[model samples]
Target chain A: MRRYVFFILMIALGIVIGIFYAQEINPVEIVDAPPNTLRADYQADYILMVAEIYALDRDPAQAARQIALLGSDPPADIVNRAIVFALEQGYAPNDLILLRDLSEIMRTWNPNLQLEPGGGN
Target chain B: MSLPLRPWYLLTGLLIGVVLGVLYAWVITPNEVLETSPAMLRSDFKSDYRALIALAYQSSADLGRAEARLALLEDEDPARALAVQAQLTLGEEGGTRIAQALGQLAAAIQAHREAPDDPIIASLQAGVQSPSQATSTATVPPPVVRTATADPAGQPTATTTPSGDAENGGNPTPTITPTGLPTATATPGAPFVLLDIVLECNPNIDPPRIQVYVTDAAGSPVPGVAAVVSWDGNSNRFVTGLKPAFGLGYADFDMDPALSYSLRLEGGGEPVDNITGRVCEDAPEPYWGSWRFNFVQP
Candidate 1:
């Protein structure tokens, strides 16, 4: 009986040691990104890409689906914010013109939605 | 009941098994185990992300920020990476919005390198220098300036007529005659010759479109000319129209991709024959399939 108990404990100890040693060999690292830290520039790019997609498909609902990826804000609100951001950032006039045209189309598509005045000062 | 049990043997066996298992898990298996992270994107998504960064760079004109974002893609050459990805996507799925955006982004990058002083580039650079000044000063005048410079000898005539017509907001019939006559007279006795032909195939658009431009030997755009495109075994006849945006020389035609095309100048010039359209990329659907024909009367 004594021999059996000693053998069982030794085996258990070996298994535990093996697992502990393995972890030391390869440690898992965890990184935490801050919450609500979406970069505004990235968001702006996302909005522009969505706008381009809208231009291709001409489907407001489909565009709205893409805009939803940014946040809960409506597509029009996101577009308005993007336009303001692009203007403030001094995006090329041609690109700004396209964005303005997109905003107009979006407004016409969704009458209830309010958009910021385009071509900012 | 068989042989006497030996505890030492059992203990040794367990120890051996544990040691072997640990060695396999930590040493041999480590290499075999594929490490994946939620943060890591697949190759396709990574390419799409790079293209979006490129487009954003176009708008923002922030190279430092663009490079930083591109670095995260872990690609040594982000532009080439994008091209390869775009090619693959086009081959697999014909012309898609993603594929189109990728191609345009690549073209834009190339264009920026070629023409750093271009209005878009200048504005972008200015935006980097002083945002407020960029917005105020870098409005859309460069193209207008280019148009003005193209007619340096006719500056007096070019400036007076166009500006007058522009202000009146009336049909510029008077201005057209003056500009057209000078272009013809400027180049004395230059034969109208076929300059070059290009085909652009875009699967994204149905019924491919062709753009034709006519220019003088001096490369001045010649307006109010007709370009004809036809293919063998097809009764359809195609003609080019003046596309002001592309210049006075520009004309366009929507063509059937299945048939080959031949281009000839309506009034004179040799015919450009045996023009065939193919899938621009290996994508399952044909996108951006196009051809360009240039006619020059030198």
Candidate 2:
């Protein structure tokens, strides 16, 4: 029984060392991160871009879909967060207007919007 | 004849340790990557990012800003990559709008490359340089500020050998053909006239094609000419030199059977009408034929 216990202790020690080495000494690099991991400033820029497109196409649905990609936050709040970030980062005035316009759209936008191709025709 | 079983348990423990180490390293508590740029996005997310950039370009028409945004992708030949993505999107359901936006952006970039001094592009550039807009442009990190031009100082010249399409004669050459010459050889007012039109029955190019080639009066291959093909009240726009394997002056549009189409250079001369695909019975498997139209500045 003592011999068996000694072997088990050795195995347990190995596991702890293995975890420490992996966690501290040689960690794996996570290169391919999703868009949700984008830095706050880049995410804000991305939101600004979506706003710019919404202004041009006036397709609130597409705009909503794009903003929704930045995690599960409400689309309106996502744009608002971006607006706050853009303000803090000293983004240009025209760019801010674009972001604000997108915010207004998202605030009143439908989450279940779907396109019916050539529907009115 | 006893096998050496004394330290076997130690060896087993070490083996288990290594496996656990690998799992711990790769799966559990993996290294967190922070402050990742757009270039670090996974492949599918990168595609979405690119499509959004194209949509924004379609809206703003700010060619410089669009070019800078594309540069973040770090593509060797942004034009060819955009063209390839446009092709990929063409096959996706409901990808027409995205594909059109990509093609339009590529065409606009090419146009700006060929004729940087065009009054329209110049005015847009002026808008892009507004102090407010300029501040946001400067906000991009250093590496992301790359130009889409074929050759930037101290950067490798872009070589366009985008995957050869089975329809485009499966022979793709490693053509370092200038994707961006930055040389303004365009006589903005010079209209491209019809040089020749040849209709062919090659079964290899199926689903029919309208190959349009535009050249200068000196007969040099002129790339980046916008060709608009309209059929039955529907029109599509594509740019030349997108596929370097075909020729620098080459651009083509897919054709549906029996539809009369008109081809014209956007902002240029008269439209060539009565352009239609034909049925070629030359091969045992009869396929629709294609038309090749050549235009040159007279």
Candidate 3:
């Protein structure tokens, strides 16, 4: 029984060392992350820009394509999330209006036409 | 059943444990990568980011904010990035406005970076609300306009007209005061009147611009004045001094040689109509070039 106990102790030590090495020494670093990897705030700002351009050009197809680049969130949902985030963050009234307008448009856009966001996030 | 204690058993257990640990650490759970930067974006997505910044700058007209946002891209030179992208994609469908915005922002940033000491640029960096803020985001109403008092017709010219010293050739002087606060010499409460029109013949100007320079009676370039360009029932409004590199008192509109445009400044003046780029015979090859229009408040 003492011999078995010693073996288990050694195994536990080895496992601890291996975990430490894998996690701290040579962990994977995602330097080339996709747009979907952006934080919630940046995602909101990027979505706002799309709304501004959409307000000008009124190109739903291109607008949908641009928003879809961020991730697979349905265009309307993505915009709606941004609107909520914008409101929470106290975005200017004009900017909030633009975001809401975009959300409305995205709601009607055909999701079947949405393009897949490229690459792993 | 009791077995003899064996070193092999200990080694086998240790090896198995290590393998499992490594697998679990690497695959089962890892540090979540949060707050990924714009700099880390994929190459194509980086282009999209640039477009977003450019478009935002077009509406916001905030030079300082544009620079700060662009810095996140980790570009060695943000202006060069904008210029190169504008050039590469200018010909694509639906790319005209994006290319123009990128090009304009690129020109503004490049000018700002190059002339850090200019007072006008200094004031611009300090940033008060710009004239663009007065106009609506989606559609800009064209400002009122009138003809030059000196030239009744106000037809754009390849050479300087007889308004004032056109000695600077077709080019508007880039910066007036090397050091000092931004000049307030521009006549307050007055509208910019068409003063001169000169066509520039430069090999570099491919999509020639309708370059505008607004100055006061003192010939000091003015910033923050509004101008409008209309062609084929479509109108666009932009404020001068936005691109300080061109000149603190300068602003320009991209002109398609195929289309003629009408220009109007904010105060009452005869609108400068029939504005279009003409061929520059003096160039090494015949090239359609930019038209330069000078406006001054009375």
Candidate 4:
């Protein structure tokens, strides 16, 4: 009778232990948003690009004038769109800088490339 | 001779095994906990504080480098490093940012500094020798200082109208002689209020790291805190001797903006407490605390 009682207690302890193990909780993971979701960082990049283009302008006044003439004299928006297209093709910041420099050189040396601002908005 | 293995021998072996097992499990086990001590907790806190300070130092250095880079671009490398160092020591974010931009301006000054034989920046530096150049200028409205009084409660209080500079108020008779360029003339007509600040620490600075954040009524950052900072990390005393800068309601000392830090709201008259995060990159929010502080207002 004692042996039988001992066997029953052993089984009961095993069941309790199993229940506790089964109820164990796992840790949760916290994931941050992807880079594309960071709109502010992206905006900062775009603004930096715009500033770079202006930086290539000869003087502050001349740069301002050149930007203003984009629609009527030479379309800066079109240039920006072309740059954007290049970006879609995986152009980086440094590449954009080179492209901007090339555009400035063209505006200064290659008169033929300059477009009327009214041609494109 | 063996007469086979005896039952007694088997029982003896089993008894020895049981005794040994009990001893290993209870008396001699390496995993057994003897006692707990508070020293371990103190050590951990100290270690955390050190880690935070190290992180802040690294961040501050990076910011200084970035600022110095701007000056390198401008060609003013020597003064660039000084400005960067001052910004770090000043422990003000706005001042640090300004120092960064001025680093670029230093590059412009470099053209002068590089030519050891010629002194170009020497003249420009002399030309720009005004506190106004280092600080911002806000048109002080009149009668504000006269109306200003300390708040009975400890919160920041303001005067309605400014009292002009004590030396010259309202209209002053000018005695000016210009040498080609614009002369330095006192604007006695304009009324202005000066914000002279004094900072005090109540208790000892036990926790080495503390972050201070000052905000305006609208919760926007108040700039120009560095120009008026005074704190001794070692003495942990009430620090005085603050100089006002040429800017709106902003000043700071004993804090570097380059590092990430958090301010914990503590009870009345207690110095502000701060926990530092990593520097250079955006600090992970809900900072890791290593130190505490107690700021007494003067």
The model with the greatest TM-score is 2
Tens digit of lDDT per residue, candidate 1, span B68-95?
Answer: 4554555765545655555455445443
What are the per-residue Cα lDDT tens digits for candidate 2 across A59-113? 7777777877788988899899988987776666677888888888778665555
In model 2, which runs have C-alpha deviations exceeding 4 angstroms?
A1-34, A112-121, B1-21, B31-42, B91-96, B108-209, B213-250, B253-298
Identify the candidate with maximal DockQ.
2
At residue B276, give the lDDT of candidate 4: 38
The interface root-mean-square deviation of each model, in the order shown, is 16.2, 10.1, 12.7, 21.1
Give a tens-digit lDDT track for model 1, residues A1-121.
Answer: 7666766667766766676667675533322221112345555645665555445445565556556655676667778887888777765555566567667666666524533333111
lDDT of 2 by residue, B110-223 (tens): 544444433444334323422111110102101111123322221222311111010122235422222233221337899888876776677778678898766666444455
**Candidate 1 chain A weakest ten by summed lDDT:** A29-38
Chain A TM-scores of all predicted models: 0.55, 0.69, 0.71, 0.24
Two-chain DockQ for each candidate model: 0.15, 0.30, 0.24, 0.01
Candidate 4 structure quality by residue, lDDT tens digits, A15-61: 44433333332211212222112122222222222334344323323
CAPRI category for model 3: acceptable
Query: Clashing residue pairs, candidate 3?
Result: B145-B269, B145-B270, B146-B269, B146-B270, B147-B270
CAPRI quality of model 2: acceptable
lDDT of 4: 0.29
Which parts of model 3 are misplaced by more than 4 Å?
A1-11, A110-121, B1-22, B30-35, B91-94, B114-298
Clashes of 3: 5
Ranking 1 against 3 by lDDT, winner: 3
Q: Which digits, one per residue and each the tens of the lDDT, describe model 3 over residues A11-76?
A: 897788779888799764557678988877778878877877777667777778899988997889
Where does model 1 sit among the CAPRI classes?
A: incorrect
